[model samples]
Target: MLPADDREIDLKTLKFVQYYIELGLQAFDDWSNFNVVDQFQTASLRYQLYEIVYSLATYQAVYAPSLRGKVCEAMRNSIEKSLTPKVMGYWKWESLLGKWSLDWDPIKKDNIMVSGYMLKALALYTGNTGDMRYTEPDSLPFQVTKNAVYKHDIHSINKYVLRNWDDSNFCIFPCEPNWNYTACNVIAAAGSVGYDRVFNQRNFERRRERFLKHLKEDMCDESGTLLPIKSTFTGFTIPGILGPVGESVSAVDTAFIDVPTSARVWSVIKHENIELDPKSGNYKLKGLSGADFIDMGSYMPSTGAAFLSFAFLANEYGDYEISENLIKQADEVESPIEELPTGSLRNKGISVWVGGFGLRARLIRFRDWTNTVVNGPPKQCINGPVLDGYDFQNVLVAKAYSPNGEDLELVLYNGRSAGSFSLRLAQLAPNASYKVSNGASFVADQNGTGIISVKLDGRTEVFTEKVQKV
Candidate 1:
């Protein structure tokens, strides 16, 4: 372990690191055995397992031991076999029959490359060393970036166009059929699977720079406004950030909405060096493929997504592009939390929060921090984003992330129950009446920040910590 006097972090760092290691182990076993596809060839399980493997490789390289070879190999085989190289990539939802059945969707195909930012390290670990090092387990995802999205010197897909619709700049950028954070996974996985040999550090940095430049030059307005999916006027030739609450919500309306300017704000902030007027909030406001920021309002979840996204970047990259206040506010954010609402069990290290209900809610926190959700919370915390359609399951998992992007607090409650439930505060104001959306009462104690004794809908339980300041 790093010394207690280590200047960079605290025991929390150790805990966080160990937690990730454990999480990786859990995911490894889960993915190795869990069916990749379902009866209808649907992807019952997500691909964050690749992320876990990548992180594990990283942790082992600097802090712990590398994973076993057999496990790594299995992971590698599954991912490589599953991928179908194209202009960019094709999305084939897998099934859960303990087999390689695939549900392929070639349509709506764009070149989005999403992955947890850890892939490069993993690939290097497993790849050519003087001798075969256990650093990379076969579980690493890509054999080569060429195998990832790049083919030789040509980029089959434009990273910018993955989520945007652009047509004019067709040569370098692709349309929104596939590019986005999801696609980042492809790049990250390839890098992790292959390491610096293929996705060289210099090359990876180049990709990030290129992606940013494209978003600024092709997708964003000089006036600082971002489109929803793509510049509406340009179609799929160019790609950039568009406004949004949900992908299902039309980009046109999202840009014009009233609550979540966060998506737009983040786009502006990420490329903050844009030659525009931050104060005027006007420049080439409309010439963006010839439209107007006429639809400037607010987006709730988009704001949340953007803020959380910024925080994620902050946590990962330490690039302070946004406001200090904004970062600090994010650092102090609380879970729209509930103590366990039905069960009497006092679960430690869990707290929950919600931004929206049903399909629109996002669980912001997960063991793999970059394991984000575009629509619903992972079942690890929330129950039934599962589409079962049965109404009466009142209590499920409630998870939330602190603004600091450091603490993950979760809770349990019945969406259907009314009587008060019990729980301990894991992430909240201790010995203090904290503010929650539901205005529920909580008993606070100190676990990490402040553990709470909770009562919601008549059931009861205990939690171990509260929101933390970064």
Candidate 2:
């Protein structure tokens, strides 16, 4: 359970998370015209899916343990969409140029940019929920044509990633055929870390030292700054690619695999990119290029996305003052918000990719990225009582968890009109009596299920503890 001081989930944060849930539920079969930006792949469906999966998984693991169903659905959908021909069709062209043949199977080859996110989403869903559905053979089937289908599961996909790493002389595999982005490679390595955690293996640990050594020695410049892209074929770093935008994003991704190094990199980025305002005394972003201001999704210049990414990095590394300041700045400058019916808040000025980052910035606590990656959802959370079947439109679930295996605590808000809403409780002790904070008592059925009605005017806090008979 969260500490008493940390129990309250603000309405803004709740709305942000709800935004992700609503977006995740929608079908992603086609996104060619959604927010197409051909130059930077950040606006692509693959990247959007990655951001959504990451945000939802983090929210479930850290805040709402009972949201496993929705989180799992979102993750599964993202994984399924990622393996589709539409989402991964670029691999055919890249493979033809690099390998002299067409390969529609994105996961089998060196497209870590796509494979890494898929693997991480799988590991997150399985590890956090203790669900093994993805572990079955041929669980993820990619249909390339009427007669061709590429089959893979969690284990096989991870094996491909590890094999790529092992075969790479640079110790860091490529996102494209010959181009390796430090950020993408870090995400791939983080996926491997999640895989080891899920299967209780030391595959990543065995290669940790070597990977870090090469990452630092071969990929970084003399000033210890992480270069953005390195050529896998020629082992040469790309000139002029290293910038504040790349460094900030890479620092956040690196936290999942290497915490100390991420912190050091963030220190440099914070110094270079952030500055203090004399009048407001709040830290603000500086020294950013026009490209940094451009929203990767819509190809339109929007400072909100850049501010959100910077704030996300600051929040990930325990720099709360800077994070808060950056967010405040973003809100002041880019303040157009759209309130959805699902109790979600969306910034109308930013792209979906930037919106996802906004949710991440709001939900993440200090060092949350590393903690959630290394040690997944707590055991008590996995085996504990879960709240379900609540009215999502009317009831905003801020915090829902069982401190032990027998108690439930929740913080909820009225999404629209304040009224009484019914909620179902699962995994309770069968036929046992429980006490609710509202002075109501109930007994669970033989299957350990019960329903409780909560009345809400604004914000309500509720807890249920099992009764111990003398």
Candidate 3:
């Protein structure tokens, strides 16, 4: 008997995503009014905004289809406003006084790293919403497109990034001052992949493949964990300065960057490093060579939310349970309904980045047709305990389909403790037939819902089958 309400949890999670997105949007709106000086800060802030907006759009694409176009429009607007004007195929940074000074090194202003993230934003927008306003001249939204600083030159940026694919064969160097960031290259490569997805082009397949191969072999630490930085000159992972502090492979950084080279990396990470408490779904880190190197003291306030970004990644990599566990951990640390979560080390206390991760996690659970192959079957939300529970702790449930897609499989897990409990299932068609593992039978009523009571001895598992429609 978990004290938590499924509807309550859902509402809180929804609010968490919405509140943080709004927070980020409002913060950026305020910042847009001011003349921002630091190029790094501006790029970083816009990246965060793009990420949250993209996550929101992903969620709306499935669960709230009516809001999809609106959210995509919002993402486009944010990208336009966030990008500084370009000069000679690069972002032109401005000073606190709103003037682009010649004193600013034009080369340094080639913020390909930020551009990579912006590309990711645009690519995700196109991927999720199928909105082609930026691509088609006839469809361009006039008010939103007018005077926009950023334009979708995905091919040009892709070519620029590809041209700089270094001798290391792994890293993508956007510029010299930012050479150490291995994650930026991961993002840049992902941007290329996204571009291919949007335009039906295979221009960078060989390049992306080579980039991934080298990244897996050369950029990982001794333990195969993705290191935060690899020196441009040295071609090896090393302790590096992030903002003002130095660290090795920081969790927050890994969450921010570390684009998975492939699905296999997620398998490796799930097996090698992540330790999810079977009962609570609360997670802890392991296997990094320099765990102490991370500034935990600096991360304390936002550590939980920062980890949510990793949870979001876990979701992206087909580790939905791991992501769910991480989300549970985040909720326990700071209830989203009470106060907003904080940001990672670089931008601590910023509520929007916090929301961005939350939204990312929530969107991962949304029902999408595209997800059918990766995620076995459509799942009904359980009203009972998941991960952490009061009465029946550690119980797990997954919905799957038989090989022919003629029957549904409900895989169940009872971790560490067991008791009899009742659970509700939603979204089944009315009068659908169902069978329990223990020779029991049930059917959904007119409302397409059902409740089942079961007794589980300690540390037991079970299954149920749903018959497909005739």
Q: Pick the candidate with the highest lDDT.
A: 2
Candidate achieving the largest TM-score: 2
Candidate 3 residue-wise lDDT, 1-470, digit = tens = 11111111232344444443343344333653222323353234454555565555544433433122223445666665554332112333332123344433222233445556656666666654455655643222212122532334545555556566644344455333434455566555556666776677765566655655665576666656555566556675546333111112122223222333333455565665568666764677555433232322222234554455556556655667777776666565533334423311112332444446556555554222123111211222221111111121233332112222223333333334466666554445578787777677788677665666667653233344566452
Q: Which stretches of candidate 1 lie over 4 Å from their true place?
A: 1-9, 27-47, 53-90, 93-111, 114-213, 224-228, 231-308, 315-333, 336-470
lDDT scores for all predictions?
A: 0.28, 0.76, 0.45
Deviating ranges (above 4 Å) for candidate 2: 1-5, 28-34, 37-40, 145-147, 468-470
User: In candidate 2, which residue pairs get closer than 3 Å at backbone N, Cα or C atoms, i.e. clash?
Assistant: none
Superposed Cα deviation of residue 221, candidate 3 (Å): 3.3
TM-score of 3: 0.56
Candidate 1 vs candidate 3: which has greater TM-score? 3
Q: Arrange candidates by TM-score, highest first: which order?
A: 2, 3, 1
**Tens digits of per-residue lDDT for model 1 on 12-121?**
22332333233333422343323333312112232333333443333322221211222234334333432323211323332112123342222123322322223333
- What TM-scores do the predictions have? 0.35, 0.92, 0.56
